[model samples]
Target: MSEVNEQMMPPKVVLPKLEKNLYEARAIKSFLLTAMVWGLVILASIPLFSVIYMLIVEGGARLDWEAITALPPAGFETGGGFGNAIVGTLVMVGIASAISIPVGVLAAVYLSILEPQSKLATTSRFLAKVLTGFPSILAGVFVYAILVITTKTYSAWAGGVALAVLMLPTVTLAAEEAMRQVPQRMRDAAFGMGCTRTQVIFKVILPTGMPGILTGVILAVAGAAGESAPLLFTALFSNYYMAELAEPTASLSILIYNFSGMPFENQIELAWAASLALVVMVLFFNILARIVGRSKF
Candidate 1:
């Protein structure tokens, strides 16, 4: 029994000691790599931080209630605001969103779910990828040629159309990718339960993918909101408040572009403030996208 117990006992454990020099070398290499990564991150962040700091210093000085709620001043005028531009931006963006979201989401559904292997779907996906890199100025020119010329005036409607064109590709591609991320098991289960394709898409896939879809939509909206060139060609910058979408409209980007070149100091200050406001708006949309992306179905 004693012999058996001895045989069953675990052998004496041993841990080999690592060489001090080799351990030190590995530790140093890891530290150096970590430092390099951090250095690169900080170096890349410098420009972004500097721009934000500059905006706060310059724009914060001129940002106030009047800036938020008053009209922009003339070149010689000293105390006015860009309230009309704010309203115009919201209206145009709203129009763009209204036009883009449903169409884009539905197209994404067709591409990712209904007819994914179809030649038309392949062509659409290719064109969408191409449009992702398509120049913003070209989009502006296209809208100018089509909507602006047909309307006989630069209007918010034209600007919204231009932005919609720019936004569509983003929304479509992102939503399609999001829908594809839905697990195949879910689709199979839905089919096993005798659910129709449309029913499965609407009831199972869309609900599961809502967070990602919202993220894409918000990101597209953020990109569209900051566009200046399209609005320049389409809306043409109104001085007074816009009473309708069919007329010229003010926007923060246009305001900044127009005011930054002026000889007047106040207008320049207003431009700075508008730039700050525009940045905040874009940042807010980005943050919203992040929050939505993290949400549960």
Candidate 2:
């Protein structure tokens, strides 16, 4: 009876040992690859960190509330600020955003949802892609000829138009991509519930893609804010406050460009401070985009 009971017991199972040589070889390769990737990342970050450090050291030294709210100093003046430039920059950027966002978003909607495969959409998409690589100076020149020359003066309106052209392609492409990412089931569900195409777009697609659209708009605004060439041709420069959109305007970028080339030390210091301020504005827009992207509808 004891022998029978012993025979009925389950047999012991032994697991096979893993090959240490193979495992160690894979582990070494993985470690080496990871080390190489980290090395490359650090290498790429050097220039960026260096630039930020330089800006902080040079630009930060001159940044102050007075600098933020004061007008640009004259060539021989010792104590002045760039308040007008800041205001002008904001005005022109706001104008550019107002002009570009509506037109670009509409174009994006047409291309992505309404008639994606149409010949007109294809041509437009191609043109927009081409414009993405278009020279910023050329945009300035085009607006210069069309608006500045026709109106017989450089003005914030011209600068805003030039910026709008540069911003349009980016906004259109980004918004289209964002809209395309909307799930097909969402569209189907909307339709199944008796929603019209336009209704679906406004209610479902636009809300879902708002974050991406905002991101593109903010990026375009940031890019427009830093552009000196276009503003040079279109807005020229103003020492005093801007009175109207039709008047020449001051901007942070143009201030930096003009100030940096001056023989005066004070203006050069103002340029550094303006450069720092422009960098901060761009950083702020990027942060806003991040926050918008993470928010739920």
TM-score top scorer: 1
Using Cα atoms with residue i matched to residue i, what is each candidate's TM-score against the true structure? 0.95, 0.92
- Over 4 Å off in model 1, which ranges? 1-3, 17-28
Tell me the tens digit of each residue's lDDT in model 1 across 1-297: 999999999999899996657458788898899999999999999999999999999999999999988999987998999999999999999999999999999999999999999999999999999999998889889999998898899999999999999999999999999999999999999999999999999999999999999999999999999999888889999889999889999999999999999999999999999999999999999999999999998
The model with the greatest lDDT is: 1
Check candidate 1 and list the clashing pairs.
Answer: none
Candidate 2 structure quality by residue, lDDT tens digits, 1-297: 999998999998898996657358788898899999999999999999998898899889989999999877778889899999999999999889899999999999999999999999999999999999999999999999999999999999999999999999999999999899899999999999999999999999999999898888888888899998888899999999999899999999999999999999999888888888999999999899889877877
Query: Worst ten-residue run, lDDT, model 1?
Result: 18-27
Off by over 4 Å in 2: 1-25
Alpha carbon lDDT of each predicted model: 0.95, 0.93
Clashing pairs in 2: 70-81, 70-83, 71-81
